[model samples]
Structures are given as C-alpha cells and as structure tokens.
Target chain A: MVRWEPGTPERLQRAALELFATRGFEETTAAEIAQSVGLTERTFFRHFADKREALFHGQELFVRAFVAGVEAASPTASPIEVVAAALASAAEFFPDERRSHSRVRQSVIGRNPALQEREVHKMASLAAALADAFRARGVADPAATLAAESGVTVFAVAFVQWLREGEERSLGEIATEVLGELRALTSAV
Target chain B: MVRWEPGTPERLQRAALELFATRGFEETTAAEIAQSVGLTERTFFRHFADKREALFHGQELFVRAFVAGVEAASPTASPIEVVAAALASAAEFFPDERRSHSRVRQSVIGRNPALQEREVHKMASLAAALADAFRARGVADPAATLAAESGVTVFAVAFVQWLREGEERSLGEIATEVLGELRALTSAV
Candidate 1:
C-alpha cells in the first residue's frame, strides 16, 4: 500500500485553501501554508510540486472514479445517462460535510483567472477521458465527443446550481434536475 | 479613431512569442521580452497585465468580429449558419503574413497548461456571448445554448485545423469543413 501524507492531503488542501482565500493566492507563500499546518515548507513541497498543486491533488482520484462510473453504468443507458451516472458516482467523494469547503474552493477558483482556467482544463481533460472510455465501449465517433463534452457542461451547470442553492439540496439531486432539464431542453424539438 | 498602444503591444507580442518558442515559456523572462523590443519593464507592464496577456490581446478583437459576423448574417439563417459566419469573419483578422508567429503562438499555448485554460475560459465567454446574442435574436431556450455552445466547439475544432494547416488555406475552408463534420456527426441516428 502507498504511504499517504500525514494529517491527510485533504486537510492540507483545506489549510492551503483557507490561506489562499484569506490572504489571496499570490500573497500566501508555501512557507506560510506549511507553518499554518505545523509542518515544514519541505514537507509541503514533498506533497505538492508547487503552491498551485495543493489545489489539485485529488484530481486523479476524481477522474478515475468518474471514468469507472461511466464504464460500469448500465449497458443500455443513453449517452447522457452514462455520463450523468459517472458524475453522480463522483459526487460521493464530495461529502455533504465538505460542502462548505467545496463551495469555498469553487469560489477561490472562480475569483482567480489562472485557477479558473486550470479548473476548465481539468474538466476538459476529464471529458476527453470519458469520451475515450465511451469510444472504447463501442460508442461511435463524434457522438462520444459530443456526449462527453455535453455531459461535462451539464455537470458544470448542476454544480453551479448546487452552489447557488446554498445547502438546500445535494449535488446529486441538483445533478438529477440539471440532467432532466438538459434532456427536456434537447428533446423539445 | 480609438487610441492605440503605439505598436508596443504587437512588437512585445512578437518578441515574446519568438522567445517563448525558442527558450520555452518558463525559461523566458519578462525582462528579456522587454529588452527584445527596446522597451522598459515599466512599458511592458503598461501594455500587458503580465507576460501571458501578450498572447491574448487579439482575443477581444476576435470576439467583436465574431459577434458582428453573427449579427450581419441573414436574419432567417439557422443558428449554425450565424455561428459559422461569425467565426469566418473573425478569421479575417488573422494576419496574412504572420504564419510563423501564429504557429509559434499555438505551440506555446498548447504546451502551457495555464495558457490552455485561459484559452478555454476565453472561448467559454465568447460562447456565452453568442448565446446571449441568439437570445436577443428571439430564439427560445435550450436551442440557443446548445447551438451557441456547439458552434463554439465547431469553431474550436476548425481553428485547430487551421493552425495545423499552417495558413496555407483560409480559415473559411477549415470552418466549412468543420461545420460539415459537425452536421454529419450530429445528424447520424
């Protein structure tokens, strides 16, 4: 089994984010982040390549879960259905307990143009991965790309709604509604 | 006439791209870029918020031309037609003689994760604007967003092809091919 970092990468991520949100990303140095977590800057560096990387540590796991969700979904599912299932499965990693941090993370990412771009790139990469997986499963060309891309867009819209709903509902529920809306919208001639 | 930046922006952009292409983005510094154009670091700051902005100054012009092209298109044209025309119009701004810089620019942007994200964000914003424009044109829900977003994707694919084709053929040809490809892709089954 691989050794994980002390106190959890998620904890460090939260600390780094609190620092970034409070002091602004440029002003918050890695040394400061390390100090806040009672660790050396060396330790922080050991975990993350740079300051920006702390924000992205869990992306690989997230991508893997999402792809697995798509692949394991019912064989007879529609293109959007498969994608929605994948997004739904990925939501389990984001617990209701972490919604506050999740919102904060989204806010921080939204306010920073560079961070926003990185997030978009990550989403695009995830969509591409999903498309490739779908193609491997015998889905046709172009449809796979469109379904993957559109599915990502629907997830984005749902995530935004979840944030906007302010704890009134879960991402899974919002995702369901968003997917339904997309289907209705697309199906309406 | 609107105020212009006295050729400083263009010169800095060209110098920065050449340096970025040869030395790589991270290896090149803002000071070297300033020195190449016989300008001071202060002057460089006056023109660009940062070094990365040099590669994206034309993006605003592109958005404007695209919107204008859509607006100038036939009132009764389909949404795809409007979007294609807008992209075609924006293609007019591609420098007739700057194939080398264009290639270098694409390469640099492609290599840098941060740059790629910014490009995606810009495209997203442009796509949103197109949707809004379509809404203003009295098109109903879902169709506006889908058509606009799909058009942007088509434009993106076409733009990549144009860049790959290395300016030998006009963007119109590439865009036409992209539109045909999109139609065939979406229309099947």
Candidate 2:
C-alpha cells in the first residue's frame, strides 16, 4: 500500500505542469511526472486519471464554489447579478500564485486539439452546472441557460485577459469588467 | 468516375439522417448510408468527409451567411446588432422543411458525447468566425468576442426551444425572443 502524505498532490501537479511546459504534453509520461516528484506512478494515477487531467485540477472545486455562490445569492438578485456572484466565487480558485502556471497550462492546451476539445468540454460542463444552479433558484428555461452560458463566456474572456503577459488585474476584476461589457452589449440590443 | 449529380448531396444527407435516427449514430456506417440512398460509397465520400458531416451539411453555408450579414450591416450598427443580423441571416439556411430533420439530428447529437464535443467545437468555431468578422469591421477586442459568443449562446438557446414538439415559432422569432431576454437579464443587473 502507498503511504498518503501531505503536499504530494501539489508536488505532483507542479512537476507535471513543468514537464508539460518543457517537454510537451504528449511527450511527458505519467511515470516521468511521478519520478520528477519522487513518487510512484500509482500515486500519480491516484491523484489524476491521466496527464491531461493534471492541468484541470480544481475544476470540480471551482464548479462547486460557483454553484454554491449562486445558491447563496439573494433571491431578488437578477440572473446576471447571480451569475456575476458565482463567477466571483469561482475566481477564488485562481489565486495570484497560480497565474503563471495557468498561463503555461493554457499554452500547452492551445497547442493540442485534444486538449482544446477537453477545455471546451470543461467550459460546457461549467455552463451546464451553472444553469442547473439557476434552475434550482426558480429561474425559467431560456433565461437560466442563457445567463449561465453568458457567465461562462464572460469567465473565459476574463480569464484570457487576466493571463496575458504584463497584466496586473485580478481574475475577479477582469471578470467584473467583462461582465459589465456583456451587459452593455446586451442592453444595446 | 463518380457522376457529380444534382441533389446527390441532399439525398445522401437525408439517407444518413434516417440511418442515424433509426440505427443509432454509432451503429450507422457511411457505406450503409450510401447504399440506403442507392448510391455508391464513393459518392458519399465526395460529398462528406465522414458520417457526422452528413448531419452538418449546411454549417459552412450558415457560417458564410453569418459573416456576409455582419459585413453588410449598417456601419453604425452596434456589435450586438450586427451579431443579431448575422444570426437572422443564418436563420435563412434552416427553412421549415428542414425542421424535422434538425430535431432528429439534435437528438442524435445529444445522445453521443463525441457528437456533443463536435457540436461545442462547431459553436466555438462560429463564435470565432463572428469575432473575426467583427474585428474586420473595426470592432475591438472583448466587445467583438463577447458579442459573437453571446450570439452563439442566444442561437443555441433559441434553437432548442424552436425544436420543441409542436412549437409554432420560427427560428428567427425564437432567437429574437432569447436575445430580448438576454437584454432584459443584463439590463436588470
């Protein structure tokens, strides 16, 4: 049996990200990722299904935070307001320290069609989860889905802007800005 | 040599859609689809890259229409308005006769993850194309992408509603309603 240890997952993730950045995601093996951190491949598999998943760590947590925020928002809040709150909650998952890592992760993902497909799938999943959260709050059909999907699109646009080189804004700030722009655009119609 | 005949593509598409609905998308083969239409497999390949493309025959035409609409919109039209016009133009590609086939196509796509991924990729591509169109018209970043993606989200929500059994509204009408809701939702924030 493998012994469970503190910081093992983090170390494995760090090693995997570094390997993916340096050696390319397709070239980096699970064994190499584990060995880089002095862990067994079994331990790596325990933390992630495969190499690609390492870059998507915390996705579930982010989604949960998003849904919880939407649930906790004032019942009187508008759909966009609720979505904004949820995005703000989800933004906590991407702290300043993770920005550089995320940039590299996105770069790696951008280079591979398989990874790009996975990224789109993740975003779609997030939108679906947010829509479910809206439905739980008694919102109607098209509104619930539209607001949730718009939230994801805002998050995507903001995340890219936040990750840009020389950018100093926090993810929450960028998300707020993007959400504002969406509102302005929609309101003009 | 395969005789490139009129209506061959439409016949192949109709045969493929019927096969996909009756036999399931995964179980249906290109050869079977061609044979069902009384055409050779070579004829099918000349029209479609694969079985999946048969269901998505008008995607390119729709995209072209969208871009052309965006290009032809009044110079002073707002980004959202331009996107709305583009969606309206694309709506012409889905006439009343195609509604039943589209409903079946959506159901088939909904049941399969691979097809769902393709659907998301196609939507993303549409948004990218729209954004590029907006950029070509001198619209700036964030606004261009936001409007384009919002257009896609509106299109998706409206398309599903329009496909509901016994629905009376046209795709354009439903899209306008969804876009109106988006405006109301965003404005309330």
Candidate 3:
C-alpha cells in the first residue's frame, strides 16, 4: 500500500523551484526533484503530470479565484466594478508569504523561452475564462472581452510591481492602485 | 550570377498558404513550396527561417507599424490618445485585400497549439514594446503598461471582429468602435 503523503504537491513544488533555479530548468530532471524531496519519480508524476506543471502550482486555483470572485460580486455592480471585485478576490491567492515564491517562479519562467510562452498562454487563457464569466453575467460581446482583458492587464501589472524588490504593498493594494491607473488612462481619452 | 526574382517571398508565401491549407502544414516541405514557385529551397530558407516564418510573412512590418505610429503621434496627446493614434496607423497594414489571406493564416494558426502559443507570445511582446514606447514618451509606470495593454486589447478584439465572416467594417473602424466600448466600460467606474 502507498504511504499517506500530506502536502506532497506543495513540497515537490518547493523542491522543484529550488532545483530549477540552481541547476537550470532543462538541466534538472524529474527524478532528481523527487529524490530531493524524498519521494520516488512515480510519486512525482502522481502529484504533477510533468516537470513544468510543478512550477505552476495551483494554477487551477488561480483561475478559479478569478471566476469565484466574479460569481461573488454584487449583481448590481457594473462590469468594470465586477471585474475590480474579481481582481481584489484573486489577490488573496498571492499573499505576502507567497510573494518570494512567485518572484522566483517568474524569474525561472523568464529565463526559458518555452516557459515564457507557457506563461503567456496561461494569461491568454485566463483572459478568455474571465471573458466567459463576464458574458455569463449578461455583459455583451466586446464589453465582456474588454472588461476581462482590462482586469487581467491590471492584475498582471500589479503583480509585477508587487514582486519588485522592497515593494511593501500587498497584491490587493497594488491591484487597486493599478485599477485606478487604468481608469486614469481612459480618462485621458 | 543568381537572377533577381521579383515578388519571390510573396510568391512563396501564397504558395505555402495554398499548400498548407490543402496538404496540411506538417506534410508540406520547403522544396514543395519553393518548387511550386519555380524557386529553390535555398532561396526559401534565405527569405524565411522556416515553414512557420513563411506563414507570418509581415510580422516585422506589423510590429514596425505600431512603433512608427507611436512615434508619429502628437507630442502633447494623452497616453490613450497616443495609443489610439498608434493603432490607427498600424491598421493600415490590414487592407481589404489582405483580409482573406489573414483569415486563412489565422485558421492555420488556430489549428496548431504551437502556433497559438507563438501568437500569444507575439501579443505579449507587442504589449511590452508598446509599454516601452509609452515610457519613452514620459508616460510612467502602471499608466504606461495600462495604456499599452489596452491598445493591444482593443486591436486584438477589433481584429477578430474584422475577421468574422460577412463583417464589412475596416479594421480601423472596428478598432475605433472597440476603443469607444473600452472607454464606456471604464466610464462605469
């Protein structure tokens, strides 16, 4: 019988990031990552489909956070207001404790072109998902797409700023501030 | 001495598209594309890095159009105005005659996951380039990112609408309408 393993995925993610950082992503093997965490390659495969999946821990949760936030927003709110609420809710996923890990993860993804492409693909998919949520709330075509993309753009810019060295603001604060900047940008028109 | 082949790349591109649409991209070879145009494979490689490059014939020109538009905008214009100017300039590349070819190219890209990733990566790079242009124009921080991304989002949404079957509006018209929609969304804030 397989032994019970609590937090196996989280533990593997930490080990994989550390090893990928030091050894290089292409140079690092799944077996080495598993061995570093005292697990077998089969266990690693069980937790993560592959090496890259380990690097993007909780991606489904991240997507769900945006959708859940959309669902939980006040029904009377405007599309933009609903998007703002959704972003504010998604910010909870990237708490202060997770900032350092996110920074490292971004750095690792930055160094590799394939990883960078995957990151972009994920963001594109996220925008599509957010657009669907907006449409489901009765928002129309171009408006639904615009609100979703705007939400993603604000969140992306804010997340990068939050990752900057010595930035003390939480992700939510940065997102709120960035959302204001977005409004300021539109005001200029 | 090699004979100067006029419209060689354009010929290769047209041939490649026809062949890819019929025979499938994976089944098609460089020699087949080149020979279809009475040129050699070496000539094809000299013009394009690979088969994929044959498909994205004017990507550099497309990118230059955005940057050029940014540079040509009125100096005192607001960030949003500048982005609108930039997109308006870039829209010149997609004339009525190019729409059908674009539809085919997009269909080819839509069918391939790798091509879709490349497309997303290109958009991300375009956003970064636009942000850099905004920064150089004295637009700061989150505002620069917001304007750049908003411009790209508008352009992207407008592009898809323009590509839709039976759609008659020009890309510039669609983009302007979409920008107005974006402004409306923000006005709700």
How much lDDT does candidate 3 score?
Answer: 0.90
- Candidate 1 Cα RMSD (Å): 5.2
Per-residue lDDT tens digits of candidate 2, residues B74-155? 9999998897898898777777787997899899899888889989988888989999999999989999999899888988
Could you tell me the lDDT of residue A73 within candidate 1?
Answer: 89
Model 3, runs deviating above 4 Å = A1-5, A42-49, B1-7, B39-43
Better of 1 and 3 by DockQ: 3
Q: Which digits, one per residue and each the tens of the lDDT, describe model 3 over residues A1-189?
A: 999765989999999999989999999999999999899999999988889889877788999998889989988999989988999889998889988988899999989987888788888989999999999999999999999999999999999999999999999998998998899889774
Q: At residue A129, give the lDDT of candidate 2.
A: 95
At residue B63, give the lDDT of candidate 3.
83
Q: What is the per-candidate TM-score for chain B?
A: 0.89, 0.91, 0.91
Model 1, B86: alpha-carbon shift in Å?
Answer: 3.8
Top lDDT hit: 3
The candidate 3 chain A region of ten consecutive residues with least summed lDDT is A180-189
lDDT of 1 by residue, B79-176 (tens): 76777777788777775575566777899999998688778888888988888888888776555776677667767766666777534777677777
Can you rank all candidates by DockQ, best first?
Answer: 3, 2, 1
For candidate 1 chain B, the 10 contiguous residues with the lowest summed lDDT are B180-189
